[model samples]
Target chain A: MPTSRMLRRATPWLMLAPSLLVLVPFFVLPIAIMFRNSLARDNPATGMLMPEITVANYARILGDWFYAQIFLNSLAASFGVALLTLLIGYPFAYYLARWAGRRWLPVLMWVVYMPILVSVITRVFGWIVITADSGILNGLLLGAGILREPVRILFDISGMTIGMVHRYLPLMILPLANSIAKIDPRVLAASTSLGASGRDTFLRVVLPLSLPGVVAGFQLVTAVVLSDYVLPTLMGSTRFRILAPAVFDEAIGSVRWALAASLAMVMLAIVAVTMVALNLAMRRLAPWARGL
Target chain B: MAVGEAGLDLEIAGISKRFGSVRALQDCSLTVRRGEHMALLGPSGCGKSTLLNIIAGLDDPDAGELRIRGAPVADVPPNRRNIGVVFQSYALFPHLTLRENVAYGLKVRREPPRVAEERATEMIALLKLDGLEHRYPNELSGGQQQRAAIARALAIRPVIVLLDEALSALDKNLREEMQIELSLLLRRLGVTTILVTHDQREAFTIGDRIALMHAGRIVQVGTTEEVYGHPASSFVLDFLGSASALPGRVEPGSPPIASTAFGLGFELTAAHRAGLAGPVRLYLRAEDVTLSREPTAVHRASPARVELSTFLGALKRQVIELGGHQVLVDAAAGHHGPRFAQGDAVYLSFRPESCFVLPEGE
Candidate 1:
């Protein structure tokens, strides 16, 4: 009986052992090594890492105007992507969660998740074909006399944003839909019955109740966009520098491993800070989200 | 604009709704007088909630007209209809404290903040939620949440308040307590209310009139005593409470003589036998049937063997086997009555007027 009770207590840890085994070495250990590398010195002459603990790499990135600009640009772009996806995804999520019929819900949800199923690289390439200067989109605009000349879309910030939004829109929508779906339809009816107008009910009841999902989706999309390497590298031109591509360039192209580790650390710090700030802001603004 | 019928706060006529192939409501019509409390009582999936939704304007009836205080509101949306609804879940906004939730409707209608605050405070006090104003919905107990939902509904001063299985979420004791508290509060406020519930006792407890629904149709609608004492059909008799139904045939006489298959014969009141001859079903309430050691005058008696006897606190319930059929008889659990055990021979007696006779298969 004692052994059985002890086994009962240890069951949860045993169940968790596999994931912990994977995460400790594959996730936590790498991060520990990366942090150590970030503080070490890189010998410029030999293109080798030297085991010397210092803040020179971090200081260099923080003090340099070029690195600072890339960091700011990455933050701005990630925020913009987060906002755009939310604007586009919230309505779609609301429709899917509240309005779609029993027969159509699964089909519509499949469509939302369809983009995620296709490889990201393939999706980015598909966007490239559509947004190229002489591609179908520009050709149609020209043919329809909407534009005299083809607009610059590929190799531009707009193109990169479009790709990022497309890639991450489902991430935003699924969470929003989950939270919105959890909202009892009866509550909305109650709001309306209490004399809140359609818009008023949504603003006062639906929106506030679904804030947990919004915060979740916003954090997910922002973090992914901040560290997203594929879309920026393929869609944006060389002049368009962001943190993810900058980190890739330093680590792979320039072989500045220490600097790359530091850059990666900065990106991780930004994501961590953003997540904390959003969480704190949500707690302050919509305290009910915590209970939810 | 077509005027509403005088003294009626709500009128639903010819309302029908179908979901796919399943009919949710079939031409359901009911009217509520101003300041009346009506209970829409039914089993689950009987379209009671659907009817409530249509009245609240949360759902549209496929073909029907709704009137609120003389105004035809078929075109009016839920918010504009000015009906307050408390859902079964109590549906209080989790984000808002009790005071804010109660004031939500007032704020939406653009009442001045001071007036909204005062009305909300008044309702909170009225519902005995004075100290819990700052607590969110999840923090409150079920009874408190229910009271808060009612408070929120009443704060708007709507013409009608609809409660959709509102008390069904509470435990038995809490539900009964709230039932009394809610009915008193609603009556004192003089708000025309429609309470939808599946519990018959809840209907009897709170409703001035009860509308019994079966399979998407309103089978009977009357005052609590009227519906309970004189059920219109076999379904009503069975649904409202526990009753022992006996299959029998009616033979015409000065007073119709009802005889069962096993040769037990009893006379039925002429009123109960009106328009019925041949086979019929006799419904006897447990309390209507009396179990005695011997036959007595003023009541027809039949021999029966006690199948089971249960002590139900205030009453002693006995399942008696009579003429190859089982009958339930309830007697007062007091010191004077002789207690019957299983397999004991007894006489089951009842007055002719207490029987509910309905045509077979009705």
Candidate 2:
């Protein structure tokens, strides 16, 4: 029991010590001071910080459904962005892993992941030009007569997803591509040589091996979408309060520290539950993967 | 399956392949007969494996047509070729169970689940792999995985089964065991199998007909007995140079005799041309000729010197320097006639039937 306590006591704080070296003073101290500052209500009776802590700041944010609706909308919008990123990324990743011949594999693969090297803001700006009301996409669509008017695609959830996907696409693609690459080409060849047509090889060998990468990518892109503070806010309505934006609104924008901490806690809980659920599902399918 | 669909008479017509500037094969052609267990034997980079790949449709021939049962494969893709190939690495699906891997081809052929499972089970049992059906490839040892690969190929009941140095991955003892087992299994199945190996012993051991490949071309292809006993070229004599050669010229005699160093002559009275007399080479297998203390009924005792004698199992195969580069002769141990000491002179003679006269080269 003493040894167990010794290990337990020594492990986490020891692990946290390096992080806390930067975090405790720089991250934690600023946040703590913010929490202390938020509690101090500006009173006409005092010239300094108020002595009494109050729940009045918390009451203001939660008092109306308009504020509550913003949180829900941000959640929906971020979830959409994440799922959409996964949809467009999966097939491209599969191509990178399979159809790219071995000779051109490395160079072609770099094109798939080349976006990651640039800044997120630059990517957002790139999406702005791409999906602008009369931009290249709309210009092409209008020239084809798919639309009568140059459709306004900017400053919307669709536009935001386009931006987010452009940024987050790499996260999803890398995992899915790794899975597709790990698939034994012989497995498909063996299947086809036995008389299964082209479609059958995909259904039997190509899809199954890429399952782990799909799940891992979904979790990654989803968590990333939820926690992203910049792209959604920069592109969409200010009322849409995704977890990351809500944290930013309280901790930096409005400087209400308690609300930010509570939102952060909720985000962590959601991620933890989602990961645990996925891990359990993976355990059931581990036998199917042949230890891959 | 029917016996009619079992064998494949493959005519590989002028197959050539080149990658970049390096030619893997150059205008190689071979005719493999129906139901023949042929082996392509060569060293690495000799294109033996490349030839096997071309036959199996794994690699395309740049300049030739591949014909199975006399039908050219100009329009058919590899998957439609219906050829079963056993790779050097075996290439068993690591993800599938031993049973699943074998059953894969059957399933792809759309044999009903019950029939596929039944046939797979039968094949597994036939190959004596019944107990470990559920095991994945990684769980099984190399030999077990190899058997599984063979079983998988056989499950398809293909017209041709190709093995690309399939036994080279196994240890020596395991390879020998599989060689006999695999050849016997293929014969029973009647699956015209072509195996590639660098090892001549394995080629001779498993092949009903062996083709010795040198530099992308099949130098010789024949039965084990023919390839060994009557080597076509000096390339073969050098390849099968396990014994010694006594090069001599045929002069006049009642029975033809070729003379070696210092008037050493080997007399032959077998069914050879009576008037054939010239400079010729005689190939003596180390095991075929023997030594004796005196002239026995079957053998003739002549003079020799035991320049170097090595004890190898039941007999001592001595290298007698009949002048240069020594000819090998098998002598029984504990023999009389002074046991010819090193550099000591004695008479060396062997059977007339055992002395083979080659056409100068082999």
The best candidate in terms of lDDT: 1
Off by over 4 Å in 1: A1-6, A143-145, B261-264, B296-302
Please, what are the lDDT tens digits per residue for candidate 1 over residues B1-362? 45877999988888999999999999888999999999999999999999998898878999988898878898888888888888889999988998999999999999999999999999999999988999989889999999999999989998999889899889998999888888888888899999999999888888999999999999999999999888988889989878999898888877778777653567777557476789888888998888777754422355678999898989888898888888888888884777777998887677877888788888
lDDT of 2 by residue, A1-292 (tens): 9999999989988998898899899987875676665565544333244546876655654676755675566557656766786789888888888887887778867877688888888888887788888788999999999999988677777677778888888888899999888877766665666656777777766776687897788788777777787887777655455667777776666654555555565565667776788778876765656455
- The superposed Cα distance between candidate 1 and the true structure at residue A133, in angstroms, equals 3.2
What DockQ, on C-alphas, does every prediction get? 0.78, 0.34
Top candidate on DockQ is 1
Error of 2 at B228 (Å): 1.4
Per-residue lDDT over B1-362 for candidate 2, one digit per residue giving the tens place of the 0 to 100 score:
12222245787768888878888887777778788888888778888888876776656778987788778876777667788888777878766789998998888777899999988989999889989999888888999988998888888888788887888899988999998898788888877888898888888877899888877777888898988877766667667646577767787687766676554565667644456577777666776665544554432334555687777777776877655547677756654434655776544566655566666744
Predicted candidate 1 versus true structure: per-residue lDDT over A1-292, tens digit per residue: 9999999999999999999999999999999999999999888788789999999999999999999999999999989999999999999999999999899999999999999899999998899889999888999999999999999998999999999999999999999999999998878878888888889989998998889899999999999999989889899876779999999899888889999999999999999999999999999988766666
Relative to the unseen true structure, what is the C-alpha lDDT of residue A157 in candidate 2, on a scale of 0 to 100?
Answer: 71
TM-scores of chain B alone in all candidate structures, in the order given: 0.96, 0.82
